[model samples]
Target: MCVLKLKPAYKDYLWGGHRLVDRYNKEYDGEILAESWELSCHPDGKSVIAEGPWAGKTLEEYIRAEGKGILGENCRRFRDFPVLIKFIDAKQDLSIQVHPDNRYALKHEGQYGKTEMWYVVEAGPGAFLYYGFQREISREEFAQRIRDDTLTEVLHKVPVQKGDMLFIEAGTIHAIGKDILIAEIQQNSNVTYRVYDYGRVGKDGKKRDLHIEKALAVTNRVPLVRAKNSYPHVADCDYFTVDKLNLDGKMMDRMEGCVSEESFVSILVLDGEGTVACGKDGEQRVTYRKGDSLFLTAGSGRYVVEGRCDALVTTIRSQSAPVRIGIDIGGTNTKIGLVDVHHRLIDTVSIPTKTERDPEDVIADVGKAVQELLDLNHIPLDACMGAGVGMPGTVDRENGCVRYSNNIPWENVPLAEELGKILPVPVAVANDADCAALGEAVAGAGKDVSDMVMVTLGTGVGGGVILDGKIFSGRLTGGCELGHMAIYEGGELCTCGRRGCLEAYASATALIRDAKRAALADPDSLLWELCGGEIGKLDPEMVFAAAEQKDPAGMKLTDDYVRHLGTGIVNIVNLFRPEAVLLGGGISAQGTVLTDRLNSCLKAECFGGEHGQIPEVRTAKLGNLAGMIGAAALLVMEG
Candidate 1:
């Protein structure tokens, strides 16, 4: 008999009480729904299910068959089950959140920060989903709002439908609306902060203990600029990626083997039903239906998906290059970095831009910037090859010129030429969005494979694209001006003179605008604490830091940003099926809360439709220096 034992997810709750405890053991003396840790253990203390007829065997018996027996190598978690699963039923709102990237976690958290997807099996009608908040709020205004109970005004309120799948990342501020049931798939770890609860009393008629300090340490409040719709992905690589197999009747999707390493594919049924056929000889088919998920182990070549409705498929494989860097240049700050190929940071530096009158003078100063950077690191100019710059205006990469500097007042200036004049090697200049994308591609999370997108959260939202291992410069407007994508028709006015662009709701500029507006309405908020009681004194960085500090106002602001972020990323994942989507910028620096929400949004918004492939979402590996390193990488590759 085939004996594969599926494990049940464990839950941890602060509001947990002993009603259920009485059924299991009388020794339990804790609050209802207190702390739940799900573990799958057979007799003899084995934690995982074995394979074949011996799959249910205890740990001792499985080990006894080390060299023989059906249990084999697949029976052990140490040998198999590369992914971990969990479920969280938050009776109250989680803190404004953050998570370290994989590299950071390996060094800090001891386990991978969770990037989970939630399936809302049950939620109250009119239940609101807390994703990200809108725009950057000044630190002072944020503080003030908490005192006045006006922080809720800043969040993106989405009425979640049952059966909705939502992806949440670490660093993103999210709260499970009152009364919700969820199914979660994520990197295995339980780390959370309680930013703000609805002030609801638990069954004990007492307030739940809040992790305010830890919550503040993690939140990103600059407002998240969510990504656009993702198109179907034709290829994928490790860490993880999903592809849409929209089949009306029968369709055969041929996957051409690229490298030598083995690969795994996962199929998720979003609608109707379908069967996945193996590429090898026997042509085995695995049948699945809506909400069903299956995996293909160590196989390559053409696989067919045939069904009544559409199906979404995902693949995970190993690849070279694990880092990517993203860069964004604003009017006030100029940043640079060196990152590993996988979106993880190696080194970084930032400086205030001279922002002098003449474009030439400002461009000429880049030489000094490079020299100063080199001197600081004690590295010779000859040792470095190239650099990437995210200019403030439209950039003509072909001619290395800034077509127009709407934000800084420059036109057709050779910013790259001036910087190159000082450097020993070459340099590439692009719009801030393109530069951010390249940074993500080279050293950010989407390192190994091509075809990916990056979003940078800043004073203004920016976007970039990578296709087939090269930056895709849109035929005329540069590649993927995602920030400009419309979220609401004729909603908020943007600096670009457009209405309801994603930037209007999710950028630092938007956050500040809303925060200031909220402060104007509520004068008693804690926001006044950070800004000396003056709304004008508010700063984006200050608000972001405060959010990490978990001030009520800060948490509210971050929560709003995360909600909008979820909506935007869902759209992007639906449009392009890239291997993975990465988030960067000042906002993403806060970490897991943002990443967790992003993963949740993908699952909630994904629909099998005619085609239903959803991509993986992750935070940028590099913190603030992705662009500088990515720019440098551009030179290295061109050289």
Candidate 2:
């Protein structure tokens, strides 16, 4: 339902020619037409919606109005629109330049770095462009050559022709030569460091500026190896995948494909004319000719391009690739998993958590474990979208710090910042309980429901609340403490010095405590035999097992435990009224036995009982891996 035709913004630079305006039919009166920002959301030049109800608005505004989901699941990983497409016509050679990578750009330029690919639309005979160095050169020699204006002498020049594709990665010294028309697809960044400008003068009659120092720091001073990309698809990378579409009026007059929910489709018309039909019924049709650009929202169903044309179709592929690292930092161990956009756990690794060591040492070990996991799985650090850490206790998710962690001996620890220093990707930190809830909501049992609550009946009854498919951490990232809610006033003392907290009576530890006391009182009970007559060895599992055998004492303990837990569940249902109440942790392994009893309790005691549909009580499907998976989901949700 969301289809957009974009109008490009024109750019006129001193080295530009009028080919784009004269040949491509770009509307411009400038003496030189440098580039046409055909599809862009960058602040420097945003393309406007050429037609539709949202006409006259910028592409960014349209995306904001429609919600980013229309961009598709793949774009979910990016905080901003990932790609920028432009048509460039060089009348004169551009300055020798290099672009910094994300790490360097973010630090020095406060923006993303550029990694571009150019598809030569047309090139004059004997025309060539710089790619990299012709041979390996020392840093000193490179700098000397730049200073002496002999940098081009050592640069590798590749002759271009119609339909030639050149992929220019970040940190590669390159320049666009004269008499060449190029279609460039690149990251949504404008940071370029120029090394040599050939003493060209701008309109002001002053020599253009040079960023030699910064360029030298980032550029690769070595021979540029030419490699051929796959056919049909000229270039593919983390940011965008581009495919060439050449249809003559005979053999291939029409191209058809379903734009899946995974990524949006972008078509840039290079030549000829066509009618693009899209939507569920394919009723919406638009006439596109040379220089026309069209955007189809993700999950648009089916589309068809008919007529003779040479175009480039670019789509995002974030889902099919492994892009995120999920880390669950428990008290005893740290678990890491490589997760793809589809929520599949490709591989996982575990490392012991030496909580007794210094925080710095622990972080270093965690970083090392991550590196080992990547190396073992044959994944490059750059390929990882980002890293998410789920740690026990209160965490400042906004600041990526552990406000306080009783289990890990950490207080106000900058966990994300520390780990980011050692890892190539960005780092995010959150409460383990929150991560579990988010994980369930995204890829586990709660995937079918948008609103739900996860109550982890573990050592301390940790839990998280999810609202509208996002973790509800409340104000200051501390509100979702489901275990601390009071259930019985002035009763058992809680670990927080509070009376009758849910954790005091409903947690696994609480259940075990009660079971031990009961066994001590009734020595003939099955609980005693299950624990080998040793009261200290009694656990919640033994008590549940005894109840399953219809033992009186075990029945009583089970009933009381269920009643207390059900009371807590009832309170949550009455308060949030979520679509589902997911039970997690060790106790949840009991499955149906636990869920059936809890459902009964909810029917008997919850508000509005016996009327309307209550939340579905289910066990967490992800189990112990929930926290790690949820941590990875944070990158997508937050972005």
Candidate 3:
């Protein structure tokens, strides 16, 4: 049967007590029962099958016998079982330690790293755990504190209570405190670096080996920044997404869920008793209780859990989704991203532009980099649907050639033709701004609207108009040159040698230049403090930051920025009147600082005012890789 109860592997450590054996009904007779590997497949310890056809066999053995299809498509991406479930009963505090991230672990330990979530099944009064640092500290201080036994002073301590949950990602320094029982769901690996062990000796009469050097290298030295809203459920990472199932046996005592073909389901019961029935006829029934773990094969269809219980349900989300290659070419560097079918950038790599090199040589270097990326990911050429190129300057989409690009200093260069020689797949090329617009329209914030305009506020203000879900460049050439539109007659000189174009006043370059000029004028302003009186190092963000502090120069620069950029957007509204205007690039990082004021400005100054149907002004969802994703979307939209 697909649904089968499993037995746990026991662990006895120095700091552990008999809580697992006494309270949880573990079979272990040991005095110190530190951990129970409830749903594990690690080589060091594997849970054995307790019931059904695979009874008496290890989880690893059952998988080998039943074939990988039982594990589901999501498991296919992983070389082994991707999840490890354990019930940790700490009578004494766990050694202050950290786990390396995937890159570090794979290189040093030859395994994936740990990212775990702890559910406090039980906690003694006033129990607490260490989580990262209270504040950012220098490396020198961090080491000295460890040596002087003052590390706990800097550690961020979180009080524990039953039912509390904390996600501990790799590189986060943490430790489980005494008098706590934790159910940990993590990536299937055992690589920890103990930084401080409280001078505890092992059974061998020596202080346990501490991975101090490795811990120093991998530990995140700053305060932990938890990824906000990463998982609406219990916990989620690349390895697994865990959700809680609670049946109180009073009002709610049963739960019905479906197991799709994409991923298998693992249920680890922490409280109460229940009978889980699986399969089409619900013939497969398994009685579960506290400390019991059940595994259900993928595509097992329907399952029903009945009784009073609190359980952790773990599942993988994505399978082997098809990918597309996106190449975003810029002046200083070229970014290549592997965009999945969902339009998410699964991976990205960058190469220095080195524009001084010959065009062919530069193109060859990009080709080599793209190939290397594809190889590293174990993705074959044919696995990618196609390749898309987003170029900095005006591009002839029909011919896949960049007609002119001052950034690359290449004119009429056949970008697609050069890539086609190396990459054996269909290649599509378009202007980077247009690609950004298309990317947003197809997969980002503009995805909901068929008609939208994207304004990129970066080195130079760039815009692309999307009409009815497609990039509208107008009869092959002269269109969407948004920055060149003259905002003020006979004013600031633009890069195109025009007087007072939107780019001169609206771009980040313009902001930097204006901020530097303002800093020179207001010597005592926060702008001077921010750049340390070195006005040459002044950036656009410094100006906005100073404005936040009510500095005269910063406030004036920002106000003028709104006026000029707002004017350009108002013109766009009057011309096309799209459903939305998505603002992207580094300036957009200011978030609401740009959108709220610009929306106010657009609403007031537009031709129709309140009477007109104005577009919603929103931040672009795709951010920096918009060009790459959008360029890739062109092939899909056209195909």
Could you say which candidate leads in lDDT?
2
Every model's TM-score? 0.44, 0.55, 0.62
In model 3, the worst 10-residue window by lDDT is 222-231
Q: What is the lDDT for 142 in model 1?
A: 56
Q: What order do candidates take by lDDT, descending?
A: 2, 3, 1
How much is 82 displaced in model 1, in angstroms?
A: 6.5
lDDT of 3 by residue, 275-376 (tens): 999998899999998888899989899999999988999999773326799998989999999987657787889999899988898889888998899999
Model 3: lDDT of residue 162: 97
Question: Can you give the lDDT of residue 489 in candidate 2?
Answer: 97
lDDT (Cα) of model 3: 0.88
| Model 1 accuracy (lDDT, Cα) | 0.57
The CA lDDT of each predicted structure is: 0.57, 0.89, 0.88
Instruction: Give the Å error, residue 155, model 3.
Output: 3.5
Identify the superior model by TM-score, candidate 1 or candidate 3. Answer: 3
Candidate 2 regions with alpha-carbon error over 4 angstroms: 1-321
Better of 1 and 3 by lDDT: 3
lDDT of 1 at 113: 54
